[model samples]
Every structure is written in structure tokens, then in C-alpha cells.
Target chain A: MRRAGVLALVVTTLAVAAALDTPAASAAASRLAWLVPVALGAVTLGTRPGALVALLAVSFRAPDILAGVERDGLTAVTFDAAGDAVVLLAAAVMTGSLAAAARLQRRRYEALGAVQRVLAIEAPLERTLRRVIACLDWRLGCAALTLTLRDGDAVATASAGCSALAASGNRDPVTREVLRSGRIVYLADAGGQPRPRRVLGAPLTAAGVTIGALVAERTGELSPPERETLVMLAAHVGLGLENARLAAMNRRAASELDTKIAAATHRLAEADRAKSAIVALASHELRTPLAALLGFSELLATLDFARDEVRRLAGIVRRETARLARLVDDVLDLSRIERGLPVPLGPRRVAVAAALEAAVEIFAGVDADGTGRRFAIECEAALPRVVADPDALDRIVKNLIANAVKYSPPGSPVGITARAVEGAVEVTVADAGRGIAPEARARVFEPYYRAPDVVRGVPGTGLGLAVVKALVEAHGGTITLDSAPGAGTRVTFRLPIAREASSAAPVD
Target chain B: MLAALGALAGAAAVLGGHGLLPPRAAALIAVAAMNAAFIATALAWAGAPGAGAVAAGLVLAASGAAAGHPAGAIAYLALPAWLASLARGGRLVGLGLGARPPAPALLAGAALGVGLIAHLALTVSRTRGYGFALGPPSVVLSSLAYDVGVNVPCAECFLRGALFNRAQRRWSLHGAMALAVALGLARYLADPLLPHASEVLAGAVFYVALLGMGNCWLFWRWGSLVPGTLSGILLFEGYRLLVVS
Candidate 1:
């Protein structure tokens, strides 16, 4: 509507100028009416449009000037006519320049407002920057604008305008200089060709740290006020960008906190579930030995037996008692582990071969009973003594032998190997049974956990490996399990040699 | 080389214009030599295929001028040359032989032509009245035909296209533009057809400098010869309005 009003005013002014400059009114020399449209256009529209209107006004006097030239000698009349045109053009240009400056000031205000609006909204940093630059391209009327920010060690650039013009704006030397000097850099257009006439850059400083640059390339030189507005705009945008960055950082931090909380909650739930399972399993395991002890006592109290029978019954009672003691010890150790207490260890330099042989001798009876399960023990000669608890080492070897025996098929043999290797004593137990499934391998050492399918009728509680693992770790040793569903199972444990106490040479 | 040629061309034209030399023979030699020089230089620098076609337009213009029939066959030669230029598949685009002078530049060119003509109409109206309606349509068309077909292309392609682009690489873009504008100024002042009067030459210097700089600016900004060519055509068409005779 404003544009239409301006157009109407220009047209009305031109019509009046035309009517007044007519032959009916006066001679062409006395006519000064044509200056009306020139002045109006200049005050209203600005330089180029006003100049065009001035051109039109001059054309209006052309015929009169030619007629004047015919009556009077051509030179004087043409000179007068041309002189009038210059006056009209000069008036338009002068007024137009002032009008242009006012218009530019208004535009810069609007551009800053638009940039601030975008910065006010909650949006991604890059998106906000792009919108700000787009406003400069539109409202501030730059040929190209680029906002470059430092993203850690990399730069994030958002550009607006012709791709050919703005694509390299981030890399422009003016932008680099602005960022380096932390001051405004102005590159005036040099060539007469129409390119970005002025490249103005201001460093985007946030919290006294120079982050990057805000660059604008324009086709015309800016007024002082417009330049001031640009400096102020850059500062506002710098703070906006930094604020956006901090907001984004906070968002990421909150997301990570949520994930960790969820993970910790899951762990707590898992621990509660394990506690319930441990109680159920402990009661079930204790019932077997307690029922045996009750039945043996009942037999002695209710029945009269011969002398040989009484002796055998007594031996049976003694063995069950010992078995019950071992089970109770395992339960106590598991409870200690659940409470997060370190295992009690009496570390001493112990012979690796002697410990392995002693643990295997206990499993020898199963091999002797014509159970196709067999033990093949191999100990390296002159094996180094390891700095480990003698009891923990024995327990580690026994637990591994038991796991091998349980997993081995009737016809398969369990192999045990102990050797001094690379400043440590290494022991391995192998079995060729159905083996553990890869999925269950991780949880096999966890208390009361077992592979469901493979351990269908397998005896004994699942505390064996867990207790062995805790004891071995307490003695400064490492244990590993390698198993597959069909490919058998292997467990290896290594303890560091007691180099300070003894050498790697055989102590045998 | 361009500075020297522009100076030599200006000297020959000034001498011929004042009757110090034969105008017809001087213009003929200058036209032939300028065209030949452009062709040789283009062939030497990049062996541009468009050079061959544009040079044909130039030589035909030279020959037509010698025969006093500049508007005859030479005017129509722009057709085949423009087609051949299109068929070269954008290789010449880099050499400023293509035609994409953007919307803004085209508008600026038209405005520039109008501005220069307005200035001419204001300053030179006493001595040389605007000959627009006084001359035959054929005369105006003939002059415009020469500009469109031969003069605009050869001059724009050789001087602004090749020379300005090369100098921009070696020197500052502003310095190169200034150099191109200078050579363009010299070329115009040296034309035998330019009026042989001090007042007329003074106006010519002012207007030609503007035209030269404007054309160089058009070529540089858009990297196209089309805007300058259109402006050249309009400029010469306006030139035909002058009643120097």
C-alpha cells in the first residue's frame, strides 16, 4: 500500500509537471515546473528511481528545445535546455542520496530485529545462525552473509545468498582477519565490476573468547550508522550463538544423565533378583545334607544292627558331616562376596605342580570308578612357585577340575596342565563334554547361575566357580573361560611368580 | 601489447580524422590489424575455437567497411558465429565467450547505455544534434548492424574477455579492470569516425571512459560477454543519432 501511494504521488507529480510545462503556459526557458516530479521521486523512492524520473522529465523538454533552436541559433537554446536537465538531475541525486541514507538506517534496524527474533527462539545453533544470516541477506541487503562458529576444533559455517558468492564467505581473508584481530575488518570493493562492494567482518566474541566471525558482503558502501548497527548486531549474535551452544551442551548432558540413571536402576533390579535366587538355591542345597544327617540318626536310633553294619553306618555319618561342612563354607563365602567384602587370603610362595597334583588326586576316584570320565594331569618340570595363597591355589585347581568332570562326556578325558610361563604360573583344565553355550558362558561364574540345558541333571550348587574366582582374584591371579555348545570347555587361571621370594628355576 | 595497440589505433584515428592521413585507408588497416591481432592472440593463448568464428565476423566487417557496405553481409554473420559459439559445449564459457550476463547486470547495462546517451544528448546537442529521426532507418540500422555483428564481439571477447581475465589473475582485480577500461578508452578515441573537434573529443573522452569502465564491469561481474555486447549495440545505436555530418 505504501508503494502504491508512492507510485500514485510520482504519477500525479509527473502529470502536473507536464501540464505546467505546456506551450500554452510559457516559453520553454521560463519553465521550471519539471523539477517537481524530480524532487518528489528523489524524496520518495531514492537515487536510481529518482534518476529515471529525472530522465523522463528531461525528455519532456526535448521538442521545445528543438523548436527553440530553429528560431534562435541552435547553440544557445540547446545549452539552456541541457543546463536545465542537469539542474533537475542534480536536485534528484542530492535528495535521493539523503533519502537513501534514511532508508538504509531503517533497513538496518529491521535486520537487527529479525536477527534478534531468530536468536530468541529455541532452535539448534546452526539453524539460528542460518536464519540470522538470511535476515542480513534480505533486510540488511547484503550480497552474501556467512556466520562461522568454532565447534571444538572444527568450524561450523552457515551461509546465506548466492552459493557462488557466499559459499566461500567463511574462508574469506576478511573473515580470517576479523577473527584474528578480534576487530572489525572492512574490505572496500576495488573493481568497477558489480561484486560485493564492501566486505565487513566482526569477530563473534563470547564471554571474552573469540569464537569465530560474522561476515557480510554488500554491493554498496555503508553509512556510519549502518556500520555501527552491524557491530552491535555482531555482538548480539555472538552471545546468542554462545548461549545456543551452552543450551545444546546442557541438552546432551541431560540426555547422558538419563541414560546412566536408567542403567543404574537396571543394575539394582538385577541385584535384587539375584538375592532372591540365592535364598531359594541355598535352602534347596542345604536340604540334601540335612536330610541325609536326619535319616542316618533315625537309623541308629530306631534299628538294632550287627557290629560290622554299625561301623559302616558310623563311617557314612562322618563323610556326610564333612560334605555338609564344605557346603556351609561355600555358602558363607558367597554371602561375604555379596556384601562386597574382600576375600581373606594367606598368600605364600606355593609350588604350582604340587598344588595341581594334590587337587587332581581328589578327582582320581571318579576316574577309578570306571566312569568313562578320566583325568590326564600334565605338570611342567621345575615349575616356578607363584606368590599365591596355597589354599586359594588348591581351591582354584579343584574347582576347575570339578567343572571339567561335570561337563565331560562319559568317554571323554579331562586334561589338566600347569606350567611356568612368562613370569607367571599358568594352569588350564579342559573337558570334551556338551560344553557350555556361548550365551551362558558369561554368567557361569555368577552365583547360583548355570547353563539350563547342559546342567539338566548335574549335581552340586553353582557356587563352585564363583567362590574360586573370588579367591583367585584375592590371591592376585586371573581366570578365563573359553567354551562353545559343541566344542568343549577350557578354563585357565594364571598367578604371578614370586620373583622377590624365589626364582623361575625348579624348587623340587 | 594491448596498451600499445590501443595507443596506435587512437593515434591513427586522430591523424586520419584531422586529414593528416587518409581516413579510409587508416580505418581499413586498423580494423584488419586489430582483428588479426585478436585472432592470433586467442589462438596463441588457448586456441579458442570461438575465436575463429568471431574473427570471421571481424574480417567481414573490415572488408564491408572498405567496400562502403558495412551493413550488408557482415551484419548477418553474427548468426552463424553465435550458433557456432553455442555448439562449442561450454569450453568457451571460461574464456568469456558464453552468454549469461545475469538479470541485474543486464539491467545495469541498459541503464548504462541510456545514461551515456542522455549525457551525450545533453553535452553535444549544440554542435551535433541528435540525428535519430533525421537519418534514414537504413543508416541507423547499418551502424547498429556493424556494432552487433563485428565490433562488439571482437572487442569484448579480445579486450575485456581475454585481456581483463588474464590481468585479473596476475594483478589485483581492480587494477585489471582499470587497465581494460584504459585500453577501451584509447580504442574509442582512436576511431577515425570519432568527431575531429576539441569540444567533441572532450565529451568523447568523458563518455568513452564511462562506456569502457561500464563494459569492463559487466564482463567482470558476470564473466560473460553478452551484457557488454548488448550495451555496445545500444551505444552505437545511440551514436547513429549524432548529426556530426
Candidate 2:
């Protein structure tokens, strides 16, 4: 309404100016004050309005032309009026075209700005796509807008201001063309079922890859600015889609990181709990023997006892001190292995039979006081030598024999067996004693873990089996425990046979 | 007492100087407030700084907000509360800055319902037109940024963080809530356009009071400023779109 009022006012001013200038204007100078309305109309409105103004300006000169014809002649007035009309018309057309182009440029600027706004919203891909379609439809004044994205072999379509594209049954030719050419395609009179009068399609490309196409449909042919707007919208849609994909990937990565962190936290907590339990148990174990040793030695020192009594008290102290010493040595050895400190091993050919016999002699001497425990030795002829540290070999044999004698019934025969099996030497120490329960077997190798039933009345640190397993693995050998309750126990191990040197004789 | 006085002085300075200062100076003040609050919060959390020092930091932050950075005001206000909670061996939730899941869910639903209803009323009254005109993208983006960053955070800080939390500490919960409602209404009353006639005054008071009380209740029930802030933002944005344009 305001625009119409302004146009009317301009026309009235032009009419008044033309009437005032017509009479005073010389024949040489054509009265062209009428061109003002034409130029103004063309710049403010479009070509049609500007043309109407030019016609009005030419008609307003009719009265002047008639007066001129009465006073002068027909040829001069006709030429003057005709010349002014032509100039006005030409100016109107030129200015109108420039105005139309400027308007389109302004619209294009607005369209780009709107696309930027749509992209700024950090929404999911589907939501962002829907918003982008809405934005394009509103900004371009289109009847309908659609976004079709390529999903592998299939196309996923989303639309605004219209029903969805006829599902998979109907293919859109414009969309297909845009996707194929990777360029903008405009369709005039898009003639298909559910056809639009006009359609503009632009390819949505991201990082140099043609991902999809954006299509806008309208009831009339799109202006050049509208088509350019569609192109800009498509570019931003491609960028928005990439951003959405990156956000989803980041979310997935964060979720995985959270899971891993939770798992690590749980493991650390469990380890801490186990360490605390071990510390508590170790303190109790150490204090009990130390208490006994101190009490007995104090009693032997302060009290004047009879000869026999003194001997008994002194013996008790000796046993407790030995137990304490053994506990300390076991702890030190386990710590060394755990810390990855090398244990001194003198690798040499050691006769297994000689080590076993010596171990048996030591066992017999310890039990010589009274408790009758018998040992039976069995060895295959030409038994092979083993490559081992001699002292370690001696300790291994002694520990096994001691365990066998301790667990067996009085007078039970503990067997020591050695046999050559393929390239390895096998040794077994069997005792007619209580065997380990199945449930406790797997965990027996864990440090400080003791079987409740086995530890009752047994004065042995639970570190023995744990240390044995570590030592065997250190030598690249393996050990196995075969036992059942009331059926006795058998411990077997295999060590690779020592390779003979070319210049050295085999030890028998 | 000194911390409270400092806070009051800072708030007065910001409110007084807001319209008087040039845009560039206001912006600088806002940035300085944000940085001061951030640094103070970090130090308090990492090294257990004294309460006096934390309070002083918050005072500086409040002055910054007064200088026209509403978002910075929220951070500055929140830092002091967080520091106080830490000194007391309490949690942020205890001071109404964090929410449990169920509370937030319930509050969100309530906020949405209220916002929608208010928006519809405003639209029917023709207070403003629907705001979704095809405008320059820059204007739209800037408006949204102002909504989320400046308006929402600043309002939440004033009502929930500084006003409600401080009142609750000094008085009973109900008393603190009454004070918050009064303050909220006082803000609306301060607007020059509000009808001064008695008949219009009652209705205006009732409307502003209800909004204020509802927001305060949301803060208290959820044990956080988040729900209340979100509710305020949703309602404000909805109103802007449907009515004020």
C-alpha cells in the first residue's frame, strides 16, 4: 500500500512538471521532464510498471503535440513527440532490467544468510535436513521442497511443504539428474505422475563427494535468484550432514572410553582389596611364631630349670626360630622372582639319582628320632642327567620328600621315581596322604593362598607350591599335581634332558 | 556478612552502570568477570582456598555481570556457591546446582507445559506476531545465541543462584521462596510500561508472581538451577516467537 502511494505521488509530480515545462521548452530541446516518472517507476517497481509509466509520459505530451501542430506544422511536432517517447521507453527498459537484477541479488544474499542459520543449529541429521528444507521452501517461496540423500544403494527422501516423494515405486527424474551430473538441474513442466510445474535440483556434495541432492518444486518457473539460492542451500546441507556424522562418531568414541575407564577402575579396586587381605594374613602368620620363640627363650633364660626341662624348652625355641627363618627365606625368594630379578642358577649336568638319594638321606636323618616313615627309590637303567643348578636341584628334591613324609601315615612308603620320557626326564614323588580338593587345585598356585583343611595342624607356609610353580617355569619345565581325598597324592615334573658336549663324557 | 555486602554492592554497580557504559567497555568488563570467576573456582577446587578469597572472587564476578555479561554473571555466582559447598563438605546438588534424573525429567515436562500455555495466551492476546519470518540468517543466529548464552544463564543466576540459594541459607525454605517470588515480581514491576492503575496492577502482580513462584519451586524441587533456568529459557523463547517477535 505504501509503495502504491509513493508511485501515485511520483506520477502526479511528473504530470505537473511536464505541463509546466512543455510550453517554455524550445523546439530544439524536446520536453523530457516526463522521463522522471518512467525512471523512478522502473527502479522502484519492475519492467511492467516502468513501461506503463513510459506510455503515460508519452500520452501526457499529446496536448503539447496538438498545440504545436496548430501553431507550427505536423512534421516538427510528430518528430518531437515521437523522439521523446522513444527515449523515455528506452530509459525505462534499461533501468527496469537493472532494478530487477539488483532485487534478485538482494534475495540471493538473504537466501545465503538463511542457509547459514539453518546450518548453525547443531541438531541430528534428519532434523537438520528437515529444517534446511523448510528454510529453502520459505526463503525461495517454493510450493514444496525435498531432500534426497543417497544411502548406499538406496535413496532416503525427506520433504517439507508436500507429501513425501512417491516412495520407492516412483523415481524423481530431476533428483536423479542432479545426483548423476553433480550439478544444478532445472526442470520446466516436470511432467510425471504427481508432477510439479517447475523443479530446481542441486547436488549436495561434501568433501568433493556427491552425497545427495536438494530439490525444490514450485507452481511456476523459478527466478534466477531462486535457483542460485537452491545451490547455496545444497552446499550448506552437505556441510551440515558431515558435521552431524562427526558428532555421532565422537559420541560413540566417548561412550567406549567411559566403558573402558569403568572396567579399569573396577580391576584396580579388586587388586587393592586383595593386597589388603594379604597384608592382614601375613602379619598374623609372622607374629605367631615370633611370639613363641620369644616366650620360650625368655623362659629358658630367667628360670633355673632341671636338665631335662631345659632341653625341652631349648628345643621348642630352636624349632620356632627355624620356622621363622624358613618363612623369611620363602618371602625373600618369592619377592626376587616377582620383581624380575635374576635368581643365581649354575646350569650344569646334575645326576638326578644322586640328588634324590641325598635328599632321602637328609629326610631320614630328620625323622631318625622316632616317627617311622619309609622311602622307596625307583629309577630306570641309564637315567639321563638334567641341566640345573645343583643346590636348587637339591632343595627341590628335599622339599618334595619333606612334604611326602609330613603328609603320609606312620610307616607309609613314599616312592621316589625317575624315568626318561622322550627328550625330557620325568620325576614323581608320591605319598599316601590327604590329597587336594578339586575346587582348591587351580588357586593353589596363587601366593599366600592356603587350603583350609590342609593348613589345619600343618606348620608350613602356603608359599611352597607357589614358589615351586615359579621355579619350574623359570627352568622352562612343567609340573603337575595328581591327587584325590583319602587316595594319596603324587607330584610329577619334567625337565629337558641336558644336551651332551662333544668333548665331555656323560655323567652316569 | 562482608561477602554478602560485597555481593550486594557488585549487583548494584552492575545494574546501575548497565545502560550508562558504552558497548565495548561493557564487553571488557564481562570478559574480566568470567575470567576472575573461572580462576577463583579453579583455585578453590584444586587447593581449597579460603572462603574469604572465594567470596571476593565472586564479588568481582558479580561486578562483571553488572557490566553486561549475563552468562559470566552465572559462572561467577555459581563459583562462590560451589566453593561454599566444598568448604562444608557438601555437594553441588545440596546447593541446588545439580539434579537427579527423575527431578530433571519432571521439571522439564512442567516447564514445557507452562511455556506452551503462556505462549498460546500471548498469541491469543495479540501481544506479538509469530516470529518465524524469513529474515537474515545472521540476525536469527545472534538472537538464539543471546537467548541461550545471555538471557537464560543470567536470569537463572540472579533468581536461583544468588537470590534463592542465599535466602534459603539465611531463612527457612518457605521464607526463602517467598523472598525469591517477591524479587521476581519486583523486577517486572520495575518495567515502566506495566499498568499503574489498581485494577491492572492486581492482575499484573498475580501473573508475574505465579511465574516467579513456579520457577522458584522448580529450582527447589529439582535441587538445581538447571531445570529452572531451562524452564525460564523455554518460556522466554516461546513468548518471543509467538508474541513479541
Tell me the alpha-carbon RMSD of every candidate.
9.2, 32.9
A1-508, model 2: which lDDT tens digit per residue? 5488466748665665556554576644444555667777887787656875776555455445544544466685567676887888888889888988888778777877777787777776677777777776776777668898875686667787652234324477778888899888876544321222457789888888888998887753465656776788788777777666677779889999999999999877855764565566567768988999889888888989999999888877776686577667668778988788866666778788888888887667557336667888898889878877776676567667777776777778889999999887888999998777888777777776666686556656567776766766666678898988888889888877888764143343
Error of 1 at A71 (Å): 17
Could you give candidate 1's per-residue lDDT for residues B37-152 as a string of tens digits? 66435533544555554554455455555356634635445533653464366545545655555798788888888877865666456434544445776666665655665566
How do the predictions measure up, each by TM-score?
0.60, 0.39
> Which sections of candidate 2 miss by over 4 Å?
A1-34, A55-80, A150-156, A163-169, A192-196, A244-508, B1-245
| Per-residue lDDT of model 2, residues B1-245, tens digit only | 33444354455447547766554454444433433443333334333346435544554555455445434434444543554465356333333444343665566636653754453443334322334343454444444544455444544555665567556544445677798888666655643334475523543464455556666666554445666656666655554443224
Ten residues in a row with the worst lDDT in model 1 chain B?
A: B39-48
Candidate number of the best lDDT: 1
lDDT of 1 at B58: 54
Clashes of each: 2, 3
Question: What is candidate 2's CA lDDT for residue A508?
Answer: 37
